[model samples]
Target: MDALSLLANPTLRDIGAGAILVLVVLMIITGRLIPKATHDREMKTAITRGDEWKQTAEETVKVNAEVLSQNSQLIKANEVVEAFLRSAGPSPADTSPVGGP
Candidate 1:
């Protein structure tokens, strides 16, 4: 009986219109907030990626510096070995081609 009364009354129509208006207002509010939320998320992601790239660049520079230091030490050792060879005479097995007939 209550359902039939609601269906037969103008009050029920007013209540339905008010409910629709509330839903429309809520939809508009959510529509405005969604883009702001998406922008915030994208900015956070960009910052994280930038930080990761910076760390990787720093690590690459450190590794290259270590490799350069090692290479300098190796070059010094090679020069010392070459100097010792120059101070010592050639072995008997090392014949000079310049003296060949």
Candidate 2:
């Protein structure tokens, strides 16, 4: 009759159909599940890195403030010491031998 009359085995049709159906089902399931999982994990990793950057920024600001505060304190202490020394007066004379020009 038509092409159906020239068959080697009619069972090949069912095997081919089943294999195609299985492949389609696998592709559909994996397509729906895989990309969403990958995106969610990548977002979490980026958020964690952002958190680390934020913490580092906060720590840098804290250290800078502490260093500035210490420097200000040192300047005040030096000013006080210099005032005390000036008030005590100077009256020292070197008795070393001088070189002739």
Candidate 3:
């Protein structure tokens, strides 16, 4: 006669049972699909982070190599200048008087 009575009717019981079965099936399907999708997203993020780290490391190595090259060139220039100064300095023979004392 009313809503509750209608639901309790034998004919309506089959309809309710079918709806409950459909809900259970959908829950199971979504339960499997959701975790797989989440796992894929997390893996993609991890891969992107790994690539960025690799790039950063490469850049650091390149900068360090440039600095080392500059330092080596500077050291070689200093040595050349030191050699020139030594050649130009007064000799022991020149230190004594030109005419005997």
C-alpha RMSD values across all candidates? 12.9, 11.5, 13.1
Pairs in clash, predicted candidate 1: none
Model 1's alpha-carbon lDDT is 0.86
lDDT of 3 by residue, 1-101 (tens): 79999888987787776797888789778774356878899899999999999999999999999999999999999999999988986675676675655
For 3-99, candidate 2 gives per-residue lDDT tens digits of 6664556775657767878888898787753578788998999999999999999999999999999999999999999999987855356455555
Worst 10 residues of 3 by lDDT: 92-101
What local distance difference test score does each model get?
Answer: 0.86, 0.82, 0.87
The reply for model 1, stretches above 4 Å from the true place, is 1-34, 91-101
Residue lDDT tens for model 1, 5-99: 86889876777777978887897788743567788998999999999999999999999999999999999999999989877966768787656
Better of 2 and 3 by TM-score: 2
For candidate 2, give the lDDT of residue 42: 86
lDDT of 3 at 94: 75
lDDT of 2 at 12: 57
Model 1 TM-score is 0.56
- Candidate 1: residue 49 lDDT (0-100): 100
Better of 1 and 3 by lDDT: 3
